[model samples]
Target: MTITETSDGSITIVALCGTIDSSTAPELHKSPAIADTLRSVVIDLEKVDFLDSSGLGALVGTLRLKQEAKAAVLLSCMNPRVRKVFDITGTVKLFHIFDDTSAAVEYAATHNEG
Candidate 1:
């Protein structure tokens, strides 16, 4: 997977492409910039084709770390298959999920403003 980050002060948007699995999840989870400076993280998954247990675990782990830092994490643009995996694993309610990047960014902006 490839991760590209864009930050506008308080929120950081991380656009992800390709599959997120056991091999790629570690790199994503260990991003120092994202782990440290981001008050909120928006993960854009529009180009993701697949995800496994490790991928979901990575997201959950990141969310937990963000929460520990008193921040938030949002997920966006999940395909039907990925969404189904989240639903099946009952992680859907654990995250702030959106249908598109704009909505996730908007949510982050609004939350930051508040």
Candidate 2:
């Protein structure tokens, strides 16, 4: 998978591309873009076409870490495939999900007080 980032004030938009499975989950978990727990993050899954259990785990792990740091870690632009995984796994409610990246960024900026 490919991960690219852009910053909007203290909020970082992490745009992910390609597939995210066991092979890429670890790399995604350790990605520097979302590693900074002090800053709120918006994970853009617009380009992610496939997502498996491991990929979901990686995202959950990120959410946990950000929660520990008292920062926001939101998800946005989830395609139908990715959204289905979250829905089937009953994990969609765990995150602040959005249909638009800008909305996610706006939410993150306002919520990232830590």
Candidate 3:
């Protein structure tokens, strides 16, 4: 799996590609980019091909971390494959999900910080 980070002002967008399973979830957890985000963060799973329970756990944990830091964590998930993990785990409702990157970024811009 690969993770790339980009910024729209203080809004940090983390884009993921490849599968996120038990083996790869730890890399995501250890990524320093998440901590580098300031007011807002968005996980863009546009290129993610797969997600499992462990992957779902990683996302939830990350979200909780951001929330504890008073930072908004949005998700841009258009892939049905990745969506299914969140849906099946009943975690989709826990986040603000956008169909595309621009919408997610807009949400972070308007709702996240001052």
Q: Quick one: best lDDT, which candidate?
A: 2
Off by over 4 Å in 3: 37-39
Ranking by lDDT: 2, 1, 3
lDDT of 1 at 46: 82
Give candidate 1 regions above 4 Å deviation. Answer: 112-114
Model 2 misplacement above 4 A: 112-114
In candidate 2, what are the lDDT values of residues 53-87, reduced to their tens digit? 99999999988888889988889999999999999
Q: What is the TM-score of each candidate against the true structure?
A: 0.89, 0.94, 0.90
- Give the per-residue lDDT of model 1 (tens digit) for 1-114: 888988865678888899999999988866655667346888888888999999999889888877777677899988898898999999988888999787788788777421
**lDDT of all predictions:** 0.83, 0.88, 0.82
Candidate 3 pairs with clashing backbones: none
After TM-score superposition, the amount by which residue 83's alpha carbon in candidate 2 deviates from its true location, in angstroms, is: 0.3
What TM-score does prediction 2 earn?
Answer: 0.94
User: Which stretch of 10 consecutive residues in model 3 shows the poorest summed lDDT?
Assistant: 30-39
Candidate 2 pairs with clashing backbones:
none
Cα-based RMSD of candidate 2: 1.3
Alpha-carbon shift of residue 108 in model 1 (angstroms): 1.4
Pick by lDDT: 2 or 3, better one: 2
Q: Sorted on TM-score, highest at the top, how do the candidates line up?
A: 2, 3, 1
